[model samples]
Structure formats: C-alpha cells, structure tokens
Target chain A: MIRTLLATIALALWQTAALAQTNHQHVSGSACGEAVLRCASKVTPAFAPDGTLWLAWLAGGQVSVASSKDGGQTLSAPVAVTKLPLNLDTGPDARPKIAIDRNGGIAVAFAIFKDKAFNGQVFATRSADGGKSFAEPRPITSSSESQRFETIGVDADGSVFAAWLDKRNRIRAQQSGRKYEGAGLFFASSKDGGATYAEARLASDNTCECCRLGLAFAGPGRPVVVFRNIFEGGVRDHAVVSFADPATAGEVRRVSNDDWRIAACPHHGPSLSISAAGTYHVTWYSNGKARKGLFYARSQDEGRTFSEPLALGRPDRNPARPYVLAGPRGTVMVWKEFDGERTAVNVTISHDEGRSWTKPVAVATTKDTSDHPLLVSDGHKAYLSWMTKADGYRLVPVGDEP
Target chain B: MKRRLLAAIFLLGSLVAAPGADTTSDFKLKPFGRGSWQEVLRAHAGRPTLVHFWGATCGPCKVELPLLGKFMKEHAGIEVVTISADLVPDLPGATRAMLEKAGLRPAENWIFSDGFVERLRFEIDPTWQGDIPRTLLIERDGTITTIEGSAEIPVLEQWSTRQRAAPK
Candidate 1:
C-alpha cells in the first residue's frame, strides 16, 4: 500500500561533465537557433550619446554585443564578450547589462555561474575604440563566492556605476556562525569610463538574494539603486538607496510595503527610473497579502517615501517583469502579459513626471516565448526593445508623448 | 529461497551504485514538458505522490533537498518525485549528483526541457511565479496540496502517515 509513483525529482550537486547538456534552446527553422542575436535568452539595449543603439544578448552560453546606428534597424557585426562558452547564469531575472559613457565608451557587465550551487561571478569588459573590439572580461570583485543580477548605469559625468546582489557577506556570516537572512547589495564605480573599476563597496547588507536591481542616476556622482530588501520579519519588499557620491552608500529606504514574506525566489525583480523632476518611479511584482501582482509607485521625496501602490495589469492575465524608464520626452513602462495562449508586451506612459498616466496598451504581441519588454531612448525618441523566438528582434518607436 | 537471494543481491548491487556518486546513467532525467503534468498525475492515479520543483541555482533548495533524501530513507512507503526548473543541457549534473548524494535511490526525476520557462511553470501552477523549493502533494483521489517555498519535513511525514491511516 506504500507503493507511490513519484514523477519529477531534481536534487542539487551531481558531478557529471560527461552528460552535461549544451543544447538548451532549440533552433527554430533557422530562427530558433543558438549563439545569435535572435536566439538570445535575454537582450539588453542602451543608447549611446551619438544615438547609436547598443545591444548585449546572452545566447549559446556566450555574451555578445552589437551596435545599431539606425535605432535598431540594422546592426554592426557582433563582438563576443566571452571567449569561451561559460556556465552563464540563465535565470529568468538574469541579463547582460550594457552602458555607454559620454565619450562613446562602451561598458558591459554580465554574470556566469561559477559552481553547481549556482554561485555567480560577474565580469566586466569595455570597448575604448568604439565597437571594434572589447578588452578581456574580468571579475568585478576580488572575493567571489557569488554575485548576480548586476546592473550598470552611466552617471551624469559619463562614469560607469555598477551595482549587484552580492553573497560575500552571507559566506562571512556562515563562517562566523552568524545567521544571515539574505544576500547583500554591493556597488562600484569606474571613474575612468569603465576601463578600470574602483574597489567594490557594500551598499547594504541583508538584501534579497535573488532578483535584479534597478539603477538610475541623480547627478554627476550620485547613483540610485533599487532592489528587493528583506525586512525584520523576513518580508522581502522593495527598497531604494540614493548614493551621496560614488563612494558613499546612502540610506536604505522602503519603496513600498507589498509585504511579500517568503523564503523562496520571486525571480521577478523591480524596475526604477528617476525623472528630471527628482521623482523616483518604481514598478515591481509582489505576491504578498497586500498586493498580489505587478504594481507601480512614485516617490517625490528622493528615495525617502513613495506614493500609494498602483496595481498594473489584470490578475488573470499574469503581468510580470515590468521595466520603467524616464526618458527626455516622458516616462514609459512596459511589462509582459500572458493570457494562456498569446503573450503581449504592454506599455503605459506618463507625460507629467509620473503624476498621471495613460492606460496600458499592447505595444507588441507574440504567440511564443519572449524576453522581458524593455524601453530605450535617444533623448529625442523612445522605443521598445523586445526579442521573441518566433519573430526576430523588434525595435518599435513608441512616440514622444511629452 | 533462490528468488529471495537474487532479489537481495540486486538490492545490494543497486545500493552500491547509489551513494555519494552519480552519473547521468545512475539516474533517469526525463523530460517534464508542457503536457507532462497530466501524464504524471495519471501515472500515480490511485496513490499518494510527492512532486518537488527545484533548480541548481536555488539556494534554499540545496539545503532542503539533502534533508528530503534523509526523510525518504525513513519513510520508504512515500514516493518522491522531483523536477528541475533549470533548463536542461545546462549544469544539470549537480541536480543528479545531489539526488544521488541524498541517497534518493529509485527516484523519478525530470527537467525543464522547453526554453520557455514561463509557459512550463504556468502548466504546473498558474499561481506559481517561478519560485524554487516548491512542492505539490497529490493524494489518492488527485487532490493536490501545494507547499510553497522549502517544505518542512515533519509536515510531509505527518501527511504521509495520515494517508496510510485513511480508509482506502
């Protein structure tokens, strides 16, 4: 009577290189292939000062970057960031981050899993001679137990600011027999336009272990970072920290109280943008009792206080992975909505610095799996950078509502 | 007496290959695709089943998995199944190795075959927003009790004990 048929059981830490799988994604009629732009798991786009759109994508265990002059209509030949195929971190929240400085310097950062336990090492590479070639990628931190969900932002002075979720503190606590709730947030800045980075510094400890971080800039040396923070009761809610300067870690302030208290991974992280009016607009997904889906909030008082949480999409449709950007024309946010069959990328805009908004609309729709919808702008116009399996890469101009 | 001797030898032979070591051949890593959920339910139609979902990168899962194996050794009557949320052809060796190290012999293991993780996750549970260390327990009548986050061993043991004591 104890005969039970268990179905799918996966445990961790099996040592086998012989049967290690290399083919994760299938080639789609020459379109669903690997190691190319179209077959990327996640794609990130950044606009250069000269309006050249730069994209970095992870595919076939390698990171590649390409530039588009016509606003993603056509691209230059791709340059490989990683020489060898690595155990790249392919988490849903994982993506290569790219930033362009004022002098057209390209700085790229992405992560690779170092061990079977899913520990990650983030690598940074820079292109000084435009898009011709990139330097050898190096680890951002000297001590590398784990680092992930790294984000890159170009400060007003054209220096690169990098922030990521770090686990060095967790390892230290475990060694000292102290209980650490979650990972910590660490940051670094490159005064030399990302050629060489300064020493990595801790912004805050006990940050959420997983999920991505949202990075923005306030002024020349000021960088603002937003991520999931573990509260006193183990409630992993979102928080924002504004750096006084590149070296100083600012106070950790609650973005909103969704009260998502769980010891598991949400995979879904928050998105942030700082308007010219000095308002902090953030969007994140929470399954807490107070909030059950995607929500957007804005804080006019720096990162100190936020507005009431505004729900995003219909609960039945499953809105996820929202991205917010404050562009020159206006502020735009995009997220994915799955209605069982087709998945649509929806967009909402605010012309008055997030004080009001337009209704969310399906800017792009695909019947197949797609990367998270992201927005990129060139001061004059904003566009949606969406990559899908069925369709190739899409860069659609969303118009300037401002 | 001869049959009992062969069975005993076979059991010993399997145990010799099951501890502290694992290769792909040591365990079966099947495909848990879009429609495999229903097939799994049907396979254990009238029996109690435990299906676990984990990923190699999941921190809490690494802690909970080995403990689950120890629990399985104590309760031989309950079936334990696991599915990896991580895409196959990745670093899936750790999952197989961990399963073996935990002494979860005779385990039914599956991996996410499709690259579209969201759709696959939706099939298992629409409410699940891709959290690891999650589990689902199905009773004889196909009533599923979901244990979100890392499962508690005592809760699982009590549930299994309760099922055995229930009238069939």
Candidate 2:
C-alpha cells in the first residue's frame, strides 16, 4: 500500500522522451504480420480422434484454423472462419476456442467487441467436412448484453457444450432499478457439431465476468466448469459446477477460498482437468491474503473435498497463466515466468495423479511477447501449445509419450 | 519553397520532441514501452502527480475514470496521468473516446506499446502483477504511494493535504 519510488527515480533518465506519436506499427513489431498459423499471436489446440492436432488462432484481426498431421512440426494452410476481418476480442482471457468431437467434427467459438463501451458478442461456426470449409459465423446466444470468455468442450458422444460469462441479467437488473454485481454463467449445446446451438440457459449468476471459464467433461453427458465466482462482499474466488445435462444447471460448489475481494476484473482465469482416475485437478492465479501467486489443487471425492492448495512456480519469477491437463501421463501443468530478459514457459509433470509433481522445467523460451501456454492431449500424450514473438508458434510435446 | 522546407523540418523534429500532448486532437496517446517509461515519468517530474493504469476490457476502470477526471479538476495543484494497458486490436479510437467521455484531457495520455507488455510492466515497477485500476500517488518530493485496486478518495485527499503542507 505504501512504497517509495527510489528505484524508478534512479532509472528515470534511462528512458528518453517519447514523441507526439500514437503510431504503434513501427514500435510494436512483436506480432507477426499475417493471418496464418506462423503469424498467430494466440493459439488454442485440440487433438482429433486420429491423433491429428487442430489449432484455432487469432492473427491479423482474423480467426483462422489449420490442422497438423504429425505433432505440430508443420501445419496445413490456414482457413478463415470469418470471411471479413472483425473487431476480435484478444484480451487477456479472450481468444478463439476449438473443439473436435469424435467422428471428426470441428466446432469453433470466439468473441468480438460489439461497441466502444466494450460490450462483447460470442460467435460460433463449424466445419462438417473436416477443415475444408466453415459455415457462416453466428452469435452463440440471441439475448446478449455482453457475452465473452466463451469455452467449448466435447463430450464422448460427439456433442459440444459451450459456456460463457454473460451480462443479460445485469442489463435486466439495470432496467428494474436493482443493483447487479457481476455477470452470469450461461451455456448452450450443439448436438450436431456447432452448426446450430440449442437455446441458451442460465447456468449460474454473479460469476466473474472478465476471466475465462475452465471446462472439461465429467462423463458422457456431464460437463464440469471452473470459474472465478463473485461471492458475498465482492470476493472473487474460484468455484466449480457440474451439469446433469446440457440444460440442467448443477449446484455451484466452491473450489477454494482465497478471499480475494475486488470490484474489478482479474483478466487471469482458472484451468480444470478430470483425470482417468476420476480426480478433479485445477489451477489458477490469486492475490488473496490467504494465498498469493499460482496454485494447484485436486479433488477425488467428486468435487466434495479438495487437498491443500499446492503453490506452483517460484515467488521471485512472478509465475502466471497456469494451465493444467489430466492426460495419458498423469496431470501436466505449464505457466510463464520472466527472468528480467526472457519469458520462459515452464512445465511440471505428475505421474501419481496430483499427489506430487516432477521438477518444473523450461520447455520453451522467448525474449519478446507471447501468449498463454495451453496444454492439449491426443489420448496418448500431452503437448504444450504456445505462440511467441521471438520464436513463432511452438507445439512441443510435454511429459513422456505413453 | 524555403517556408515549406522549414515546415517539413519542424514536423520531423516534433516527432522526436517531447510528448507535446494534445488531448484535443482525439488524445495524443504516446506509445508507452519499457524504454519510454522514463520519458513518461519525466514529463510529470517535480509535480505532485497521480499516475493511473487502465485498459479497455476492464469494466471497473470505466466507472472510476470519469470520477478521477473530476478529482483532477477539483484539485488544481495535482496532475493526473492515465496510461492505457490495452493489448487489443482497433484500440486507439476506443481509447480516445473513453478519454473524451471521462474528460481526462490536457493530462498526459499514454498507451501500452505493441511489445511484450511484461517488459513494459516490469520497467514501470517490477512487482506489479498487471492489475487494473492501479494508481501511484507521487508527491512533489518523489515519494510514491501505490494503490492496488481503485484509489480511495480519502487516500488521494491525504496525499493532497500532505503536498499542501509540505515546504514549498
């Protein structure tokens, strides 16, 4: 709350005067210059049934997709999901989402800013014939004040479940002169790959609106989601919800109590993965007085009880954007750390569920801007998918190949 | 021809000259990077300033920014500078509109450059974890008070009172 500025003052003369310029084109060359996979600034990966890796990425103001036959060494030509460029939502948690169901169906979801007030709208499109083409993109829900941070997951029966933070209830409260806190968690399902969606329904209210929701399927029909929820007194903590089906919203279960109270957005979210051992593994960033920095925890009693939070990453390096995946080689976690020179993507592998983890290792490093590290598994192995400016798109396989 | 030559030279030199801020022209937002932090701080050096960080995606910042503009107006001695930490596409227009709505002009308006934002953030203060609505109250003697979330008016008022009480 109170700190002196001696260091900044010592460094005051280092940075010279800036011009009356607002042009960022020449100064900010961290972004690759095209709408292709190599030029992508943000990338999300999903593995197909046949071990093919499909990636949806945002680049040059366009959402494009490409497939890799052999473990991301090379990618097929990019295919545009939207014909014309749109005002994409490339915020901290906002990016293009992809889900590949069994029988090779591809579904994609992304958000775009609708107005200057920052009201957002989520769009969904699909490809029936592999990645050859895509249908026209449409809003995920009709009644939208602002819908963002949309997440899509595929069930075993090839159905896709979509969940997002929506502000429709906030608008309703505004009209009725009732005060509203945060946004609501809303969801829908596409039984026929994402060509069309069922009616959107409210899953939970007062969920933190700015962060992304962690999504994974429990069984064939059930979907589990972890999100930053707005508890009483404006405490934004992590919570998990299990759905009986696409339409039935389950009880909101508290994941952990970090007691972070703020009236603003974290931009940082949470990640969830359900192991074959049926253990629920989650990781997130929190600044609560009870805990700080990145942490990981697991639940084996069907979201009933969780182990003590296992803090991840070093304190001095400033660990952030932790992603966890329960895969063939147990649970894999990855995050980004800066060393005052280069930002490195570090990984830790746990062979015995979440009981313990291997020493964290830096699998990739870049000296410039980068995207959050995301983990994807191909039913056989887990892979780290990251996009960086110094290096291009990286798809390094983490953990051992089982 | 000589007059046109002089005008071109003047325009070229202005590019490197100080961030001759012009909020009237839709916000003269300079591209802020790691190397530009010193320059930004130098602009408000020796003056009691309130440096606030915000972004387009942050909802709470939208509500607090207009009030901050009013606070600066009410306190004529203290200066308020806002730096946009947005990394989104099509940002300049939106940022300008936000400043106009908040009435935070004639004050320095800076935007995060397109480099690795972590570097830019680290340069400002290595400990900042990129939290929005974060502000720093700089006294005339260069003492800084860091506010994590929104800045409380009482805190700002205390800083103002301290500055007023300090030796001129």
Candidate 3:
C-alpha cells in the first residue's frame, strides 16, 4: 500500500509541473516578448489528415508543437518534441518544418547549430502517439561539415523525406586543394513510418548553399524537390529534381533561367506545388533580365519545359518570398511586398490551372517586424499563417477577409 | 513633478548630444590587411568617406557594384571602402571574382571575421539590423548618415560636395 501511494504522489507532482509549463494563450495578437525571438520568427503550420491544424515553432531551446481542432480558432497546449539542450537555426529560411502522416505520425525537422562558426547538423524527431511524447531525435546527416536549410515532406504511404543543403563535398574539395563552387543537395528517407531511415544520398552538386529547399509530393511515394542551383560562372538558377524512390534521384532539370549570378546567399527560396492535372506550378523571386521581381510559371510535362513567366507584384514594390499551394479548388500564391512605407501580404488565385490569375489582393499589413507568410491547406481551402509584432500570430483563411 | 520634468529635460539634452558622443573608438574590428576600420578613419580623418557593406549572396549588392565602381572613379576626393558581410567560413574567392567581374578591383575591400554577427553589427552602428547593401557617409567630423538601401549617385555626390566644403 505504501509503495502505491508513493507512486501516486510522484505522478501528481509530474502533472503539476506540466501544467505550470503549458502555454494557454490561444488567441491572436498575443505578445511574444524579445526573449522568444525564435518562436515569433519561424512559425510553420501543417494540417493533419483529420483537418486538424498543427503549428510548430522554436521556443527557449525546445521545439513545440500545438494542435487546433477548430480551424485554428483555439489551440491546445504545446508539447515539447525534444528535451535536450538545442541551439536551433531559426533564420527566415532555416526554421523547423513539421509534416504529419495519415496514421497520425508527427515528424519535425530542424538544424542544430554545432558551434560559433555557423556549422549546423540536421535532426528529425517523430511521435507515434499523437504528440503525447516524441522519440529521441535522429541525425539526418553524419558529416561534421555544415548541413542546414532543411525541408520535410510526408507521402501518402506514411513515408517521411528530409532534404538539406550539405557541405561535405565542399569540405573534401577544400582539403584536396581543389575549388568547389557550392554545396550539394542531400536527402534521407524513412519508409517504415519514421522507425528507420535510409542512408543519405546526394541529389545534385553545385547547389546554392544558403537558400531553403522546397519539397512536395508529385504522387504517392513520389517526392519532388526544387532548389537554387549554381550554373557555370556562378549563375544561381532554380532546378527541379524528382525521385521515384527516396534513395534514387532523377535528372536535375533547370526550371528558371533568371541568370541571377551572385556569390551571396539571397535567403530567398522558391515554392513548388503539383496540380491535379499533373502540372507543376512554381513561383520564385529573381531580378534577372529574363523576368524581374516575383514570377510564376507552370510545367505540364513534368518539368521538362515550362510556360512563359508571368510577372506578379508591381515593379516599384519589392516583392519577395513567394509561396504557392495547389489544391482541388485551385492554385493560390502568397507573397510579401514592401511598398515605400509599409509591408503588405498579397495573394492571388488562379482557377484555370495557372493560365491566368485574379488581380493581387492585400490581405494583411504590418509596419512592425514580421515573418514571411506561409500557406497551409486542408486540400480544399488554403490559409495564411503569419506572425507580426502588431498582430501576434494569425491563421486567416484565404477568402475570409477581415 | 518638478524633478520629473527636470529629468525629462536632461534626457532630451542627452538625446541631442548622443550622436556626437558616439565614435568609431567604441568598436573593436579586425584588420583586413588593407587597414583596420579605425586606421582608415584616422587616415581620412578630415575627408568624407563612404563605407559600404555587402555580401556575395546578395543580388542587389552585385547589381550595385558597377555603380559603386563608377562612383569611386568619378569622385576622387571621397574615400571608398567596401566591406564584405559574408561570414568568415565562406570562401573569399567568390567575392574576389565578383569584384573582378564588376571592375571594382581598385576599391579597398574587407570581409568580416568569424564572430557573432549581431554584436559586430551593433558595434558598427547601434541602430543597424544587419541589412546588406547598407551605405554610410561619415563626414570629416565623425558625423554619420546611414542609408538602408543602395546609395543614389546624386545623393552621394551632394553629400561629398557638402562635406568637402564644410568648415572643419
């Protein structure tokens, strides 16, 4: 009897501790002070198979995942995915990504800063019990060199794929006294519901080092990735690579010929989504002679060729960080633009398979510091997720203008 | 209430004098072999100097390079120093190649050493938030005028003329 009573007391103390640490603020415009800069900056949202909204962010050295069943009207208490001390890279393009499988499996991937020299390691964690707890984090890359700017996607068959910019080849070339222009795109896949992962493989070399990679599903078990590629003479263009299986990568096709030849990281990445008609809708930012500002195009023949680029946003406005989401309803593109005074979150919808788009509409405005807008969809409706100092965090449905 | 009013006046006075009090001496920067930031300031102590911060990955920075080269060539009285905001780990070859391609080889160049980028940015200018292609015009008397974007040629020429004609 005494042993049972002691166990009950221990359980009670644990519950009290958890309650004290849980976050209860679910409303918009909540204040996130300067101490939690990472949380405020990189808020990524995902939708589960059951239409439940899940949001993930970095706060106080831990990755927190929160769920909302009422279409993000209210959020449940956040659960920590990793308990260990972590130095997360929470830059605009290097935030943690969340992807949920059909079986309620939760996967989160992020880069851990290894040292003061900006070297980082990519790690992923999964929870099989619906976010009650998470398994130990697994390293996706084994190299000591920097591996960061990760993207995660979940296939319909409950498989998880994580891709990142890896610098192992660059390090090896430097050691051998050879010139390496840029890093390589490497990815690892888990087929058995995050239980085990295959060996990491390189998709392509000479990829721009600092931009985030985009990953989306072309079909069941088929994942496509797009990233900035470094061509001959440092021309940074966008390339698409599709894989039938996670381990084998197909040919890398150049998608955008912006000819933005620069040696520095723009911190801007492209967005890709496959429509129901097997066409790819891509949007990106480039100030090249081919097309300037934000541009959009579609490929009907599996990225072998693309339509002529259609420019969006005004020439005077600095439009950047475009994100595209294609669903059964249509394709929606959201981007941030800075008019001379304030920044506005603009959106345009294309109903006829990206052939034409409605005029751009400004949905949100903020003069304070804010994050790049992200889109999360339930396969029928797309919602914009943005966090700003004036507006806190909001999940506004695309058509439900306020 | 009287004491509070006096304190507010004192605060206003300090706010007005703050810019003159702050100088390059408050910062400790690594020398890039061209010279230390302080040495460059001291050498051109009584002349107008243009300090431009750029990075190899920045697209606009590359676009502005030829313009900056033209500005440097046209204006002989103003000192121009271009600093690469790329991290210490990034290879300097790419930056050198960009400079060569833009015909900006004659400009004095520098790159940031490996350190906390925010702290370094704060040391350079307390209000700066580490934006690239940032241009600053430091007058002969240590007054600093900061521009968050690319410098316009007309504005640069006007500032240079004003600084050169200002009584020291």
Candidate 4:
C-alpha cells in the first residue's frame, strides 16, 4: 500500500510538471499579483561623483527620496519631495528619476497624471545636506494647463534642464498641453540647482503625440535631450537636442536617418546616457523595414555626430522602450522584447562603447504587462528597475555574475 | 445506489466533523496543518481554487465579498478558499462576520498561518514574489493551470471548463 501511494504521488508530480511545461516557462521566482504600481516598487538610484547612492521612488502617489550614505547596505526612510495634493491623479505617480550634482545635492523629478492623462507639472526638490531633508517643491511651470510627459536632468555645475512633449505650437490653442493637441518637445533650465529657471524653449519642432521625452546630461556643463522628432513629412524619428550650456541655448538636431514612417505614434522613445568620457550613448526601437530591432547610436564629440547604429536584440525580437545607463567601461541597455503575445526583459552591455555589445541576456520573464525597464547606475554597480504584474517596480542588481 | 451515495456523504461528513474533524484546511494554519493543505488540494485537485487573500481593513475586499459569495454559490464544484492574510489573531471572528454579511457558507474559509507570505510564495512557485488576492488553479495532476488575481465566477468557471477539457 505504501508503495502504491508513493507511485500515485510520483505520477501526480510528473503529470503536473508535464502540463506546466506547455504554457508555463520555469521562472526564477513565483508569480504574484498582476502588474501594478505599488509603494515599494519604485526605484531611482543615482551615484554621486564620490560614489554615494541616492535612490528615489514613489510612495502612495507621492515622490520619496532615500539616501544610502554607505553604499546600498542600508537606506534611509524615504522623504517626500513632491507634495501630492488631494486633487492629484487617482493612481500612484510614475517612478521619479534622481540626479546628483558634484556637490552632493540631489534633484528628484517626476510627472503626475490627471484625468487619465499627464496633466500635472514636473516638479523637483533639491537637498543641500546630502539628502537628509528636501526643500519645498517649486513647479517647473506654473501653467494650469496640462504639461505632461516631462523629464529633468541636472548638470555638475548645478544647472537643471527639464524637457517634455509640449502642445503649445498649434494654430488653434489646445487644452491641457497635450501632444495630440498640437504638441512638440519643449525644454526649460534652471541656472542654480533648480532655484530659478529660464523660459520654456521649443527644442524640436517634430515629436510624437504619445511618447515621453528623454533628457540626460552629456557632460559636466552640457546636456543632451532625445525625443521623437516629428518631421515635415510626418515621419517620426528619434531626434537628439543638445546645448553647451542651458543658459546659452542650442538648436535641436535630428540624430539618425532611419526615417521610420508610420501613420500612428509608436509611443516608444529613445533613452540616452552620457558616459564618464563624455560620449552620449542612446538606444531606441524602430520598426521601419531597414532599421528594425533595438538600435544603439553614440556621439564621440559630445552631441555632434553619432556613429553607425548597431542592432542590440535578435532579428525578430520587437525591442521596445530602451533604457540606457553609461557605466565606467560599458553602457547597460535594458528593453522589453515583445515575443508574440508575451513579453520579457532583455539586458545588453557595450564594452567598446556603442560599437559592439554582449549578446542580450533575458533578465525577467514577464507577461505583456511590464513597461519601461528603467536603468540606474551608481558608477560601479548598475541596477535595473522594471514593473511586473505581481510586484509593481522591482530593483535587481545587474552584472553581478559576469 | 442513491442510498449508498448518501451513506458515503454522511461517512465523509462524519470523518470531517469528528472532534478533530478534518479541521485541517479550515482552522488557523500551523506548520503541522500545512500538510492538510495538500489534502485540500487533493480533494479539489480537479477543480480551480480561488484563493482570496484579504485583510479586514481592505475596503475594496469588503466591497467585493458579496459578489464573491454569490459567485461561490453559483459555481457549485469550484473550491473558493478565502484566506485572511491579516496578522491580527482576532481576524477570524471579523472575517467570519464579513463573510456572514455576504451570506457565505461555513465551508469556504481559512486563515493563513503566520509567515505564510514567505513560505507560500516560494512553495507555490519559485518565481512568485508575494502579492495577495492571488488565485491559482491546481489540476488533478498537480499542474497549476492558471494563476491570476481576483477572478470573478464566470471567469473561474471558464478556467474550470478549460482545465477539464485539456488533454491529460
């Protein structure tokens, strides 16, 4: 009888294993709830010039900043930088990005969604005393109209640059500053650590209606901003706009000649990272026949010229929403690979700058629910944060194995 | 034959009601009681298990309970196990009251043992990070057919039908 019972158990286990093999892939961890934006999942870790870690995430719809003064072993309680008002959007705000200047001051920036749209202004609060406390949030723009899809970057000299998909250029005035309502990419800068700002300037006359703008600091005093550049022919291609200094201003330059022509907006925009050696590395997804998979382009002379683009993912992989982090010796690129009905996160490392990269490694196997895997590097240690159906946003340390 | 079936029901009921009854899946989960979950899984192995993880303070859970009770009643064969993920020991009484308000029968309940979140997540699937209100369906062969969140009755019935029709 005992032998028979053991046989039954073995049979049951085998049957389960076989059945699971069909629709299920053995994942590294068990799955949990559907994809959501929970309080604990937001992650934004920026390395100071001296290697101090400043991580920021959104908690209960408010922006929270935490500092790990001694590496990442311990993190301080998240202090709120954005005052999430009562009338703010119902769901938790998107994850906030943090940038640390040479002097150790941190500027955390995030956009608030209202009425099922990105209506809230992008705001940033600075911490002068190593992130122990944050100053009051001063609005990047005080316009009551919707100013959505905004991204911010702070230079080593304390100059701050903020860019977004602006809709202010149409013949007929649009409501809520939405891109579909006659929008283009616009930027604003603050000369003194987010204290005072200049008037918003239209960086690129071309832009996509649905994609968010990506802005990053190319060097100590320079800035490189990339967004979906809308052209005269309505061919929406990734455009790179740069400035020697935020105060002096510069014209936006269309980076690549992919000329992806699609009637509808793809919603996937380019992610740019500036390396320590002053190279602006960018990666984005385009489905135009000639240039399909994920593409990597870099500018050796700051923002002037980009090398021939390199495909990062497999030929058939629909790579979308690329997030790039330029490390000491390499650039880490994370993107979602759309495999038919399912989706998974892929990571690649570039050792010879953007010229070549390691074969893509599948990090997290997720469903169609995950979005925009954000890359954060503290120089030496790089981390990838992405939203999962079960856990809102999870942070995993990258490049630990090889 | 009908009498035999009734007799078997009574025998199983007595077996389940004996002083210890099969107090296994229904009572507060302990490490020892966890073995009973296997029995529960075996009993309902052919059917889908809707494991509703809820706390007393969750307003949304409260709003959805009546709907769940109706769903349980409508889907006769499916096993609807509502496990309280709450830490409070007094939760059992409050949970029972909430279920009573929703007109839930006594057969559809269990309180997760302490530290269940850590153990159960891995035990269910190594890839699972902890998230509550997690519903998983275990096939007769011990295969997990579908895993998702807060599925309503029709969807549960659809999954059940799909599981039954799937090739062995």
Instruction: Rank all candidate structures by their lDDT, best first, as comma-separated numbers.
Output: 2, 1, 3, 4
Q: In candidate 3, which residue ranges exceed 4 Å CA deviation?
A: A1-39, A399-402, B1-48, B54-168
- Candidate 2 off by > 4 Å: A1-30, B1-26
Query: Model 2 over residues A172-229: C-alpha lDDT tens digits?
Result: 9999999988899999998889876788899899988889899987787889999999
DockQ of candidate 1 is 0.18
Please, what are the lDDT tens digits per residue for candidate 3 over residues B1-168? 667655654543443232123233323233343225566677767778898887664545776888888888888888888887753223254466666566666677776652233334444653343446788898988888976546777999899889778986
Clashing pairs in 3: A263-B56, A264-B56, A264-B57, A265-B57
Better-scoring candidate (lDDT), 3 or 4: 3
The model with the greatest lDDT is 2
How much lDDT does candidate 1 score?
A: 0.78
Tens-place lDDT per residue, model 3, A1-402, is: 332233223222322332222232111112442224233556789998899888887655456788989976777877776563244564446777899999888888877654333466677778888878877666665555778888888877778887899989989998999989768999888875664467778899989877778788888777889888988888878889988777778899988788876555666788999987788888887755466677888898888888888888866566767989886567888987665346688999888889988889999987654667888898768898887655667787884322
Ranking by DockQ: 2, 1, 3, 4
In candidate 1 the C-alpha lDDT for residue B114 amounts to 67
Tens digit of lDDT per residue, candidate 2, span B81-145? 89998656336656777777888876788888656788888788776667787889987777888
Candidate 4 residue-wise lDDT, A78-111, digit = tens: 6666443211211111346677777877776665
Which of the two candidates, 1 or 2, achieves a greater DockQ against the reference?
A: 2
For each candidate, what TM-score against the reference? 0.89, 0.89, 0.71, 0.58
User: Per-residue alpha-carbon lDDT of model 4 for B17-105, expressed as tens digits?
Assistant: 22111222343322212344565676676555666655443323565678778877776655777666542222344465666667664
Q: After superposition, how far is residue A126 of candidate 2 from its true place, in Å?
A: 0.9
CA lDDT of each prediction against the hidden true structure? 0.78, 0.80, 0.70, 0.57
What tens digits encode model 1's per-residue C-alpha lDDT throughout B1-168?
667655654543443234323465646688777788888888878888899988777878788888888887787777888888853234456677777777765678887776566677777777677878788988888899998788989899999998898667
What TM-score does candidate 1 get on C-alpha atoms? 0.89
